[model samples]
Each structure stands twice: as structure tokens, then as C-alpha cells.
Target: MSLLNLAWHSLWARRGTALLSLLTIALSVALLLGVENLRTQAKSSFASTISGTDLIVGARSGPTQLLLYSVFRIGNATNNISWDSYQQITQQPTVKWAIPISLGDSHRGYRVMGTTNSFFEHYQYANKQPLRFAQGRALENTYDVVLGAEVARKLQYHLGDKIVVAHGLAAVSFVNHEHYPFVVSGILQPTGTPVDRSVITSLAGIEAIHLPPQQQAYSEQQLTPSSITAMMLGTQSKLQIFSLQRQINEYKGEALLAILPGVALQELWGILSIAESALLAVSICVVITGLMSMLSTLMVSLKERRREMAILRSVGAKPRHIFGLLLLEALLLSVLGALLGLLSMYLILAAAKPLLLSQFGFYLVLTWPSLQQLYLLLAVVIVGFIAGVLPAWRAYRYSLSDGMSIRI
Candidate 1:
């Protein structure tokens, strides 16, 4: 028989132990690849969350914090920049287009962001992709609201449905601006970003909700937002973005922060470095444990195979052939485990897609294994080969006379 066939027969003789070892290694490989998947996908998701905009300007705060509140809508802003500052900055010689953003209210659990129609025209994500309406048109009236894909689907809301705006992020709030409920004029398609969970309204709608009941009747043209949560700016010249950012940061009109979304994303990722490292370390440890278990199984099996080794040697099998056979068995198990692990990893990701998107706005897409992940699997195979050395050597040392007498 060929070495591959012999290895398969040898493993089949100890099917239970071999099966367990294969599963353990497979799970380890899956976990290792899963971590890598999360790392790369997270970067992609966050990086693609906002694009085409050159600068995200907000009230004075940490760049990462501003990114969290303005783009990700994770937390409340420290303060809001004045609308006057917004107008002033947008008029700079290098400004291309700007969208004003106001936040801090919600419908049900989704964030309520206030901005002009400019938002629809200027905002982009995932390679300058513009927002498309699944149904209805963009915000056109003062009391008009736009429901994101998740909000519309989860709430079962449609165009013309009036939604009460709550004062805070709670599902049920003590204060509700029911008097000036917003009519859902549009629903945005899913972009796999924070926008998918937002409840959007015109800037005037946000301000109107704050006004007294008597003053609620208004035209958007007559209303001016006194303050806004943040602003997204597209520069006229990509080369002068840094200079404009410096100018915005030093603006005499107000204390503000200007951040390049890409750099701030890197900073946000830096904040997650510790957690990422911890997760990676834990995955590595699990893989090590799995490999160790395989090694233990191989070593224990060598004792039971002493007679088989003796018989093979007697049948004219050289030490080299014995070594090669044992080594091939380890290689076979490793290769099978790696392949099984890859399949399991993709399955898990597929199952986790909706949950991750719903819970954290993380959209998982299955792609081929990254080069790094392939190298990791390759390394696992190498380790498995090395792990088989002791048992292979011990089996190679077996003499023909060893199987002549049996030990109870």
C-alpha cells in the first residue's frame, strides 16, 4: 500500500481518538481564522462607514470621541458647535460641500439625526456610494422624517406613519414630542453602517420639536438651527485638507475639532488594540492546546502500535519507511483538520451575519481566506508535523523481536 493509504488505515484503526483530535484541531483553526476575519472585517466596516467626505468637524473633543458620536452614533457629543461656526467654516475658499448634523434624540431605540437635504446629496459610504431610498423621496418638508432600513423593518413603519420623537435614547422615555410628530417621508436602503439604524429628519424638524406648541407651526426656510452636533465637509482640494483642518481647529468663531475620518478611524482602531491583542492571544492559546492534545493522542497510540511496528519491520520495512508512515499520518490529520476548520469557520460567519449586523452594525461578508489566515493554517500543519516527531521516532526504534513476546 502507498504511505497515504497506510496512514488512512492506521488512523481508521483508532478512529475514536483520531476523530477527537481532528475535531479539536478543526475548532482551533476555525477560531484562529474567525479572529482574523473579525479584525479585517471590522476595519473594512468602520472604514467604509463614511467616505467621500474629507473632514468630520465637531465641537471640541477627542477625535475618536467625535467619530463615535457623529459617525457611529455610539455616544452623545460633549457639546455642539454653533450653527454660525458651521456656516462660517463651510464658506471657506477650499470648501466643496458640507452637511450639518444634529443628534441626541431618538425614535424607539434608533438615533434621530437632523440634517438638511444636502445630506442625501453629499453623504456617501463604501467607495463613494450614495444613499438610495428603498421607498419614498428625500426629506422635503419641515415635519418629514426618514427611516433607515433597520428602523423601518423593525418598527414596521411606512411612509406617512407619524413617529413620536423622544428626548433621549431610551426605548420608552418620560418626555415625548408627540405634538410635532414627524411624518415618515422616506426609508433608506441598508448600507451595513450606522445609517441603517438612524431615524432621520430635517434640521428644522429637530428644532421644531424643541419649540413651544404655539411655535411648532413653521416653515424650514424661516428656521435656523442655533447649534448642531457635527458637520461633514468635503474639501475642494484633497491636497489642502490638512491646512483647512488646521484653520477649522483654530477658528476664532468657536472651539471645534476637525478630524479626517480615515485618521480618526485609525485612532479608533488603536483604542481597540488591547482588546484585539487579547482576543488573538486567547485564540493562539486554544490552538496550542489543540495541537498538544493531538501530540498526546499520537504519543499514547505509539504504545499500542508497538507490535504493528515490529511486524512491519519484520516484513522488511526500513526505519525510514516507518518514520515516513507515521509522519504522513500526522500530516494527513493536519490537512484534514485545516480543511474542516475552514469550512466550519465560514458556516459560523454565515450564521452570525444578521446577528452582528443587527446588534452592532457589523456586516460580515464571506470571502476567501486571507493570505495571513492561510499562513496561519500552514503553520498549524507544520506544528502538527513537528508534534508527530517523538511518536514517529519511538515507533522507528521498535525491533522485530519486540512483538514476539506479549506483555499483559
Candidate 2:
């Protein structure tokens, strides 16, 4: 029989221990690759959440805080930007278009944003892609509201369904504007971004809900909000972006912050880098532990294989052949383990795609292993070969007399 066939028979004889060792390596590789997938995709998601807009102008606050509130809807603004400030800034020669964002209310757990028709027309995501509607049309009246894909799906809302807005971010609120419910007019297409969780309404709808009750009728002139949470500004020229940002920062009317979304995203990632590194380190340690387990299995099986080695020697098999056989077993086990690990990873990702996109608005592209992942697989094979060196040497050194006679 060939060396490979001999190696296969030897492993099959010790299948229980070999299987356990293989599983350890497989689980370890899955964990390492999973961590890498999350890290790279998270950065890409955050960067593409909002694109095309040149600046995010919000109430004076830390750049990261502003970005988190304005774009991600993670937190509330420290203060509101007055309508006067929004108008004056947008009037600048360099300001090409602006989208106002007024926030404070919620329906269920989803945030409510008050914006203009400008938002539907100008807002972009995922490489300057325009927002698309999956149902109905944009806001046409003060009482009309648009639903994000997730919001509509989770709430089972459709056009003309009236939803009551609550005063705060809590899922269950006691102070609901039950008297000022808005009818759903449209549902936005899923963009796999944070916007999927937002409930959109016109600026007039927000203003009317908070205003004192009377003959509750609002017109286009009265649609102007008293203050807004933030403004996304687009500049006419890329060259004028810096100049416009500086101008907004130095404005005297109100304390306002203007931040480039890209810069804020980088800073946010920098803040999160430590946690990401720690996760990666832990994954590497797990992979090493798995390799160590395989080594231990090989070491223990050595003593049991002494009689088998004696028979091979009697058959005129050289010490070099014995060494090569042991090496081949280890290589085969690792290669199988890596393949199993890759299959498990893809299955997990496939199952998680819908949940991630719906709940977190995070979309992970399901693709074949990346170059970096391939490198990791290559590294595992190299380490597996190195792990076989000790056992291969020991097996080669065994003498024919060692196991020719049975021990009592």
C-alpha cells in the first residue's frame, strides 16, 4: 500500500481521538474567521451609513457624540439647533442643499424623525445611492408619515394606518400624543442602514403635535419647526467644503458643531479599536490551544503505535517513510478541520443575515472567503505541519525490536 493509504488506515484505527482533535481545530478556526468578518464589515457599514452629505451640523457637542446621535440615532442631542440658524447657514453660497432633522419622539422602540421633502430628494447612503420607496409616496400633508422598512414590518403597518407618537424614546410611553396621530403615507426600501429603524414625518407634524391644542390646523407657513436636532449640509464644490465647515463652526447665532462624517467615523472606530484588538487576540489564543490539543493527541497515540511501527519495519519500510506517514496524518487532519470550519462559518452567516439586517440594520455580504481569510487558512496548515515534527521524529527513531515482543 502507498504511504497515504497507510496513513489513512492508521487514522481510521484511532478515529475517536482524531475526531475530537479535528473538532477542536475546526471550532477554533471558525471563531477566528468570524471575528475578522465582523471587524471588516462593521467599519464598512458605519462608513457607508450616510454618504454624499458633506457635513453634519448639530448642537454644540463632541464630534463623536454628534455623529452618533445625528446619523446612528444612538443618543439624544444635548440641545436643539434653532430654525433661524438652519436657515442662515443654508443660505450660504457654498451650501448646495440641506436636510433638517428634528427628533424627540418615538413609536414603540423606534425613533421618530421630522424632516422635509428635501430629505427624500437629497439623502444618500451606500456610495451616494438615493433613497428609494418600496410603497406609496413621500409626505404630502402635515399628517402624513413615512415608515422605514423595519418599522413597517415589525409593526405590521401599511398606508393609511394611524400611529400614535409618544413623547420620549421609551418603547412604552404614558405621555403619548394620542390626540395627534399621523397616517402612514409611504414605506422606504431597506438600505441595510440605521434609517431602517426610523419613523419619518414632516416638520409640520412634529410642530403640531407639541403645540397647544385649539383649532389644530397647520399650513405650509406654520410648518417651520421651532428647533431641529441637526442638519445635513451638502456643499456646491468639494473645494469649498473646508471653508463652509469653518464658517459654520465660527457662527455667533448659536453654539453649533460642524463635522465631516468621514472624520467622525474614523474617530469612532479609533475609540472602538481596543475592544476589537482584544477580541482578535482571544481568537488567536483559541486557535493555538486547538493546535496544542492536536499535538497532545498525536503524542499519546505514539506509545500505542509501537507494535504497528515494528510491523512496518519488518516489511522493509525505511525510517523516512515512517516519518513521512506521521506528517501526512497531521496534515490531512488539519486540512479537513479547516474545511469543516469554513462550512460552519458560512452556515452561521447565512442564518444571521436576515436578523442582522432587520434588527440592527447591518447587512453582511455573503461571499466566498476573502484573501485575508485565505491567508489565515494557509497559516493553519503551516502550523499543523510544524506540530507534526516531534511525533514524526519519535516514530522514525523506534527500533524493530521495540514492539516485536509483546509486553506482559
Candidate 3:
């Protein structure tokens, strides 16, 4: 028989076991590739969210904390800068334009960010791309609101719908400001950032909703306004960022801090670096375990195939034929497993990309594996070759020893 026929027959004789082995290898490959892809895209997403902004100014806190609250909307701010200070900073000669962010409320688990129309004009993400409107425009009045793409899709609200501003971020609010409902004026296009999951409005709208109800008789009583959350500042000159940051940090008027958004984001990733490392280590282990399992299974099956090998020798088949059969089985099974794993990975990433981007500000690029990934695949093939060697070697040795005998 030809080498191809011998290899085919050998695999078919043990189809049950071979198929199981292939499945296990395929699953392990999928796990390794999936984790690596997630890690890479997550880092890209985190880093892309706040590009182009010079500084993030907020109440006193660590740089990472400020980034989490202001940029990622991951936590709450302890204090807010007064409107007077905000105005003073914006008037600086080095300042080009400023966009203040007032946050503290949420609509159905998404954050509410109150800013000016300038925000849509100036704020950028993922390669400095401006926020595009899917429907309508930015809010012109304090009573108007603009929903992010995710918020619009999730809530099913269209333009001109009335939405209530709650007292706090909770779903159940006892202090509902029913008197100051906002009209949905616009819905922003998807930007693959936390902004896509937020409710946007004018700064005054945030203030108005939080303002205490006034009794008809209390004209003279001083009103204590709710503190604003955070602000993102843009400058005319890139060189002025450090100076402005220093000024904001040293201001004697209020307890506040300012940071370069890019720097703070890097610091935040440093803090989360351990999680990334752990994921990488786990993937490597999975790949190693997968290769070992394939090797062990092939080696075990060789012991039972010795009689079959001797019979082939009696039928005038060369020892090289038996060796090629074992090696071919290893190559065929491994390549199939790898292809299946890659396909499964593509399907999963396609499904999860939108959710990942909106929720975590990560835009995953799904494409062929990178050079490093290709090298890893090549290593897997090399591992298969090594695994097949012992079985092929045993078959060759048996052929020389049997010498046409019908011995067991």
C-alpha cells in the first residue's frame, strides 16, 4: 500500500481515540488564543479612550483614582471644583477650550455626564475621532439630554422622549426631581468608549436636577448646590499642559488635583499589570498541557500497534512506510485542531466586540494572527513532530526485530 493509504487506514482504525484527542487539542488551542486576544484588545481599548485630552482635573486623589472616576467612570469623586475655579482656568492665555464634566448619576446602570456642546466638538477617542451624532444634535437647553449609542439602544428611547433625572445613581430614587424632566434631543454615534454608555447633558442640567426644592417663602435662604464630579481640560499649546497641571495642583482656593490623562492612564494600567501577566502565564500553561496530552496519547497507542506493525512488515511494506504513517497522523490531526480553534476564536470575538467596546472602551480588531501568534503555531507543529517520533521510532525498531516472523 502507498504511504497515504497506510496513514489513512491507521488513523481510521483508531478513529474513536484519535477524534477525542483532536477535540482536546482543539479546545486548548482555542483557550490559549482567546485569552491572548482579549489581553491585547483590552490594553488597546484602555489606552485609546482618552487620547487628545491634555489634562484631567478633579478633587484631591491619586492619579489612578482620578483617572478611574473621570475617564473610565469606574468610581466616584470625593469633591468637585467650584464653577469660579473652572472659569478662572479656562480664561488662562494658554487655554484653548475647556470642557467640564459633571458626573454622579446614572440611567439604567450607565453614567450621566453633564458637559457643554463644546465637548462634542472637541473631545476625541481612538485616533482623535470626533464624536458623531447618530440622530439629532447636542443639547442646547438645560432641560435637554443626549443619549449615548448604547443608552439609546438599551433603553429604546427616541428623540423628544421625556426622561426623569433621579436624585442619585440608584434605580430606585425617593427624591425624584419630577419637575425637571429632560427631553431627548440627540443620540451620539457609537465611539467604542465609556462615553457610548453614558447619558450626556448640559452642565446646568446636572445642577438643576440636584438643586433643592424651594418653598415659595424662602427667597433669602442660601442654596447649597451639589458638588460637580470631574472635568477634562484642553489647551491651546501642548507645552502648557505641565504648567497648567502644576497650577491646578497648587491652587490654595480648593482641595483639588490635576493630572495628564495619558500619564494617569499608564499608571492605572501599571496597577492592573499583574492581572495581565497572570492571564499570559495561564495561556502558556494551557498550550503546554495540550501538547503533552497529544504526545502521551500517541505514545500509549504505539504499544498496542506493534502486532499490526509486524504484519505490515510481512506484507513487504518498508519500515519507512510505518514511520511515515504515524507522522502523517500527527500532522493531520494537529492542523485540523488548529484550524478549528482559530475559527472558534473568530466567532467569539465577533460576538463580544460591541459589548467590550461600549462597556470597557475597547475596540478589538479581529484578523489573522500576528507574527508572534504564527510563531506559536509553528511551535505547536514542531511539538506534534516531536510527539510522533517515539511512535514512529518504535514501529521502525519492531520491523527490524520481527524479520518476517509470525511471532506475537
The C-alpha stretches of model 1 lying farther than 4 A from their native spots are 219-222, 400-408
State each candidate's clash count: 0, 0, 0
Give the per-residue lDDT digits (tens) of candidate 3, residues 1-408: 678776777788899888887777777778778887887777787888877899888889888888897877788887788877887777888888888888877766677888889889889997888999999988787679999887888789999999886656776777667877899999998877888788888877776665665632222122223446777888888888899889889988897898988888788888888988898788778777876777777788876887888788777888888788788888777777777777887888899887876555466789789776777667777777677788778777777777676355
The alpha-carbon deviation from the true structure for residue 231 of candidate 3, after best TM-score superposition, in angstroms, is: 1.7
Model 3 Cα displacement at 252 (Å)?
Answer: 3.0
Query: TM-scores of all models?
Result: 0.96, 0.96, 0.89
Indicate whether candidate 2 or candidate 3 has the larger TM-score: 2
- Give per-residue CA lDDT, model 1, range 1-408, as digits (tens): 887898999999989999999999999999999998999888888789999999999989899999999999889888999877888899888999999999989888889999988999999999999999999999888899998888898889998999999999988898999898899999999999999999999988888888888773566554788899999999988998999999999998878999999999988888898899999999989988988988899888877887787777667777788888888888888889988999999999999988987777677889998899999999999998998888788777664336444343
Point out where model 3 deviates above 4 Å.
1-5, 212-227, 315-324, 351-364
The TM-score that candidate 2 achieves is 0.96
Candidate 2: tens digits of C-alpha lDDT, residues 116-230:
9999999999899999999999999888999999999988999899999999999999999988899999999988888889999999899888876675676666767878999
RMSD of each: 1.7, 1.7, 3.1
Comparing 1 with 3 on TM-score, the higher-scoring candidate is 1
